[model samples]
Target chain A: MQALTNRVKVLDQKPLTFKERLYLPAIFSGMLITFSHLFKKKATINYPEQKRPFSPVFRGLHILNRDEEGRERCTACGLCAVSCPAEAITMESAERQKGEEGLYREEKYAAKYEINMLRCIFCGLCEEACPKDAIYLTETFAPANYSRKSFIYGKPDLLIPDPTKEPEAFAKAQGGIKAHKEKVR
Target chain B: MTNHLNLLPYLSIDFALLFEKLLLIIVVVTGSLVVAMYTTYAERRIAGFLQDRRGPNRAGPFGILQPLADGLKLFMKEDIIPTSSSKWLFIMGPGLAMLTAVMTGAVIPWGSALKIGEKVVSLQIADINIGILFIFGVVSMGVYGIMIGGWASNNKFSLLAAIRGASQIISYELAMGLSLIALLMLTGSLSMKTIVEQQMQGGWGGFLGWNIIYQPLGFLLFLICAFAECNRTPFDLPEAENELNFGYHQEYSSMKLGFYLFAEYINMFISSTVMATLFFGGYDIPFVNEANLANHWGPNIVALLGTVCLLIKSFLFLFVFIWVRWTIPRFRYDQLMDLGWKKMIPLALANMVITGAIVLWLNK
Candidate 1:
């Protein structure tokens, strides 16, 4: 019975030496090893008080973006709805009225946009499919809610804050995503 | 006969002594419960630290209030007794377990006597003549609790677990007793106070005065047996969660379950205390003349210091108990039995004989 490889050694069945049989020395060494860990840095973070930093390109919840002039950029093209792997996005388009130039960037605008957060996998396919740079994945994820109805994020829930009126919230929602794109360019 | 009859009133139980003993009992019982409660918290905290994680820290500062929260939860839980089980025996199981666990503290000498006015009060609850034997008896009775609990549960797994627990205790008790016989031979007394006082004499090197210096093998054997007696890890096959589905207390719920768990921690505390008393010189402070301290300060202060020293020793033992639990994996059932019957028994016997021979030679 030749061995298949030199590395494959037979099991050692020899009787234990007095020291090995005693088991104290080995047990003490093991105890000392565990004792050393007492002084080492703990790996756990106190979760609520401290948070791990997210990467710049980290895709989380979907947000409907607005142009620099605070006009809605989405034209309800349905490309995002088609590309969304989870089929979470749905919207209704309405023609821009004669006096609504300041409200909408284009003639066709989304009157009602809804994303079912429960079905969303946050794969960022919708963001990639959008030609108007309207739908983007934000750094913040969806928070826990009581009901399924609450999880269905509507236009109000998904829209970025009007940048002109609330610059702080708009910048916070933007996070490092804009800076990440600028660095790449 | 008339003179003896006249002295009966004076001999009738001293009111002061009765009062002191009652106070001591209350202190001991309450202290044991508090320490046992904290031990559960400490176990989790220590386990967490070893594994590089934070344990329960939400209850209070450093999770000091965790045990209280746990106790409240257990209390609030609905008490359930199985329909098929023997209700009386099921109820008595945990009660007996707790009783036997706390009863071992009676003979342990916590410290020296305190001098108050003209009356000297011993710190121990009862300095019984056969203190070690009393501990053995109580510890053995602990098995009955588990046996009854398991048998009354009407579950086969619980019954099997109960049998394992009983047999393990019985098998290990032999080697444990054998190892202690050597220490008994050296001390020439079964009384715990006498053994402690003997160690306090500090012959030759002061630091080497403890019985552990004389009977290292005996101490090691006794320690292993103590682990078995407590049904801690490595000898915890009786409560092997995976195989036995929580073992003897499988059907127990609410405070009955809590009682079983509480009894385990109390048992660990008592075992640690006994190990400290027998091998580590109970309340004897090492490398310093306690008598000199008593002379300089007061007997009360010295007694307090002794009590603190004993507590420190017991805590160290408890830490080691927890440490070993987290470090070592449980042994296989056959391996556990083999270790108990074959390896431990022979080593214990040899240690006893060698100690006896050495004691004889030293006397010669």
Candidate 2:
């Protein structure tokens, strides 16, 4: 006998008029609406040829960062491996040998770093947990690969280009995320 | 029979004429197949555009090669036949559909006769006097494809859909026939060539010539019935995908299934051409004197242009068919029946009576 939220409405069950029964006018109007849509901008981005820009904080694939001096920043601390919800990261630490200072930023460095991209959730937690700013989630996502072994990204796959040796690639790898942040600020 | 056979040799066989007609048949069949192929592509593209999305564009430039790829895929698929099904009838169903679909094109006058060297070749395959009746007969037979296919499948959904398709076609045929009666009265002939020629007769200036101007209600009824006959959206209850689980061809696989699907597109193409021929002046170029053009550029060129014009008209109709498909939702089966039997039949009957009276008054 009492309505709950005053949202209930009576159904319009009245019989249709002669004009409504004809259906042509309504059909024509609906057709006109659809026809107009032919000129409207399409929502799809033609995935291969064009791509939508990711947000500044958009976390995608992991990239092992290199400092401006082209030295690896990771000190083999294993914080990223601990913070990774997916447990996708693994590494083997080796004490920096003599004459290896140019290669590594710290006394202790990762000898073998791998990220199973199939397991990585792109949550950016690993990036947040890294103390030395060794790892970051790049704007680029993981690409498709045929083999499961190919998805197990090794140091060669995850490492950013040496800035001093390949400045163009290094800048390109860092360009989107940094520029997006700057623009937002 | 022997005497007739002997006279046939004296008739000289008209080998050149026979060859030309045979060539024309091949051209017409292949051309229709190509159009139907492109129509599937267009339907997807138009549907995409209407929904504000990009459709298939990966195969080739703007996906022009998509249909070829689709045909290849269909060809490569594994053919399966249910063990319970009637072997011959199940096989014959899609074949029969393909036959009936292509047969309708035989009587449609594609263009004026072309003059070649020492012979005049008509673009039409067969300018049968009872062209409209022939179309009706073939279209009616099209139902057997669905009926036999559905029944042979031994599936309840398929059987139900087949019954629905048969009833829908049968009900709509009444209204369709009644509406065409008025047009036939106006044209004074059932021959498509004669109707088109009549439409083209009274100069190039007035809109009064096209049957749509005179039998507006009849044209509307015919158009609606045509949509019903084509089993397109708004009347696609027989293949209500969600409800009927793929309908009459549920058991079909591989190219057999492709044939059933291809038959629908062929039906749409033929219906569009028929509508153009009956109501819109088939190959008559509007606002241009074709005779003058023929005199200036030769009959062959003019005939080609007329063919192009007819194609353009049919394409516009096809576009509208696709447009309407994407715009409207399917009708309830009961509503479909009600519309076909009660509303359309009465309206078409009334239109026929009024047109007959007017024709009589004009004659008096």
Which stretches of model 2 miss by more than 4 angstroms?
Answer: A1-11, A116-119, A145-152, A163-168, A174-185, B1-13, B203-207
**How high is each candidate's TM-score?**
0.93, 0.91
Compared with the true structure, what per-residue lDDT tens digits does model 2 show for residues A119-151? 989888887788987887767778888899999
- Alpha carbon deviation, residue B332, candidate 1 (Å): 1.0
Weakest ten-residue segment in model 2 chain B by summed lDDT? B201-210
lDDT tens per residue, model 1, B165-239: 999999999989998999999999999999999898875423577999988889999999999999999899999
Q: Which regions of candidate 1 are displaced past 4 Å?
A: A1-19, A179-185, B1-11, B204-206
Q: What would the DockQ be for model 2?
A: 0.80
Q: What lDDT does the true structure give each of the candidates?
A: 0.90, 0.90
